[model samples]
Target: MAMHMAMEVDQADDPRLQAYTSIREKDLTSGHGARFIIEGKVTLETALRRGRFKLESLFLAASRLEPLADLLAEVPADVPVYVAPQDVMDTVVGFPMHRGVLACGIKGEIPFPANFLDADAKTGGPSTLLMLSGLSNHDNVGACFRNAAAFGADAVLMDGQCCDPLYRKAIRVSSGASLWLPYAHGGTGADMVHAAQAAGYEVWAMTPRAKAQTLGTLRVPEKLAILLGAEGPGLPDDLIAAATPVRIPMSSGFDSVNVATAGAITLAHVFGARESP
Candidate 1:
């Protein structure tokens, strides 16, 4: 009874209420210098279990203590666990009734561009890299990283225009897959393509435009960089012209597929092709 009472007291005074309430792209960017916020219980749990475990702290509604006892047990005792009312949790997050938990995890460091390219320059073999230019949606960016891992791609390179894969919504949508993926900031869309090619990656720009060659028909290289753009705009003509254009055949009238979906399919084919090479 005493322990329960203490828990309630702790809950009433929890300072994380302020932290949770302040969570947002800007708040995350300022508070801990965090580039991302891994919001909600399931996402936090998934991240913790994934071994990368970038969590800074955990927050839970006091009422949910009993239900999350097992999950909370595995967390290090030193880690701060704060409890609050469900209303407080929801109110802070600008939502209602999540799983009674959320965690703030630090974003991982991105790798250098050289790590993914220039095999002959002494670093390593031709590393597979993903380039996203003008890919604005966070969900798409997250999904792309998920597929990159599944396809065994070495790392991801997002140009200035792409969405941040570490954003809260993106991280949740990815089921925490984005946490471990190696990625680097690709400076500019045009410069990114040029740098990738200079590093010896055969850039294959994916587009569904009329004159595009089918991805199935193209010759896959030992070291390839697959480039994808936003859904509606597709790859800008300059970017497409800059890269070796490739396409995935679709039934007539379907026109095109989602950028992330198309990227996944292309990644799979590229992965298979690499195996034979």
Candidate 2:
């Protein structure tokens, strides 16, 4: 077991505890340089186990520390662990931290779409990638990450307009899947599709148009890139035209499904359709 040197803080403004103050505002305007906040026990525990992100510090309610002692033992001695009463934590964060667990972590490097896809191809296992465009809603982004992880997608590629998967609420909603999954952000929808194509992936754009190939009938490729768009606008027509347009068969009355829901169904189908050697 690793030894822990936990420090106790009585005041919210203590310089060492600054990372816990006005967290929501700081998260929006000034994300901690290379670091981000990890909230709730599950998310923090996963980060500890993965060791992908380096833990900068930990702030917890003193009452909750006893139950988490074993987990805390895994923290490196050089890292600081701070404990405060729940009331003090609530005040420091400008909100009630019901979970009473929070940690500061620095994100590790993430690969670009082409590099990620290429690496997967080299691994010899079939590759599945999810591509997102203009997905500005954090909830949708989080759900997509959860679904991608659940359905065994190798990585996610998002346009510059997509919300950060590491956002606090997003990480919580994904059950920390965002931190574990490989994802790349930047480029437009079209750019991502072309990049996937250049990496030897067949791109499939999800849409509701009548003429699009239904998910059940389209041939699944060995290395596939499933493209999704924002809630209402959907993928641009030009992007759809540039790739194999696909639609999930549904009752005729509904125009479309939620982006995340559609992604889940599509990922399940593609993952299920992989051919055995």
Candidate 3:
């Protein structure tokens, strides 16, 4: 058992504590461990009161915190409660986390794409899928998954260029959707596109280039997978030309929408069509 230190606020914002904060925050959804949170509190009493977050430990300012007899009784005898001065806590965390309550929990695992497909295979097959290509931004990847889940896509597949869906920032940015939605990371975009087509899907590449067919007019098939590229450079020309291009109609002058936003709209369209026919 690590020796628990309970002191005053003198050490708040210490560099050591800040590093721990960053690690704990980033490790929440990582498979290495579980969900961990640091709750800031003005005093130990306040820290004890906000028990809903399931605090694993309490860090407080020794000088400012007034030891609560009742709260101490409730905590496990072995749980170490550390108290430091307000400044100490601030110094440790790199900022003023006056609340002084921090806890870590084990985050649940996200389901594999194969498992999701196995379960859903019997139900009219998957109608909509999101195929990501070279999306590096963790926030964007998570956002895309969140959109896919919201818009009724059946699965999300990540290519080699995409970030890990289980990343900590991705998990939170996805509002925990990362854990709930079925996702897989494998294969090149072209390889997955070929596989999807082989599986009876009409692969549609979402792009802004004018040569592509308008999204509204495409004869959407029963099963569809929307392929999206990263920001800036857009989908590789080869992939775009190889896929049946589907362009979302925006104001004639506007360029394009955010990749995730466009993905949501495209998914809604595909699922909407599935509903009609």
Error of 1 at 178 (Å): 1.0
Candidate 3 has what TM-score?
Answer: 0.64
C-alpha lDDT score of every prediction, in listed order: 0.72, 0.84, 0.65
Error of 3 at 110 (Å): 7.9
Model 3 lDDT per residue over 1-277, tens place: 2233343334435432432354433545444545544343222333244322233555545643454434555555545566666555555655665444443333444434444444555346558889889898988898998888788887787776787765645655665555556677655777767766766678899999888899889787778888999987779988887789888888979969999888988888777777784
Output candidate 2 Cα RMSD: 2.2
Q: Estimate each model's TM-score.
A: 0.83, 0.92, 0.64
| Clash count list over all predictions | 0, 0, 47
TM-score of 1: 0.83
**C-alpha lDDT of residue 117 in model 3:** 42
Candidate ranking under lDDT, highest first, comes to 2, 1, 3
Tens digit of lDDT per residue, candidate 2, span 1-277?
3324778888888899887788888763123355678898999888888736678899999887889989998887778999999889999999998989999877655555656555655445578889999998979999999999999998889987887888887888888998888888776777788889988789999999999999989878878899999999999998999999999998869869999999999999887777433
Question: Which pairs clash in model 1?
Answer: none
Alpha carbon deviation, residue 116, candidate 3 (Å):
7.7
Q: Give the number of colliding residue pairs in candidate 1.
A: 0
Best by TM-score: 2
Who is ahead in TM-score, 1 or 3?
1
Candidate 1 C-alpha lDDT tens digits along 1-277: 1223313323433465555664552445323355456666677667667636456767777777777676777676555676677776766666775667677666645443444444333254646778889887878988888888889888788886776777777777766777766676546778878878887778989988878888888887767889999979888889999999888998988878898899899999878877773
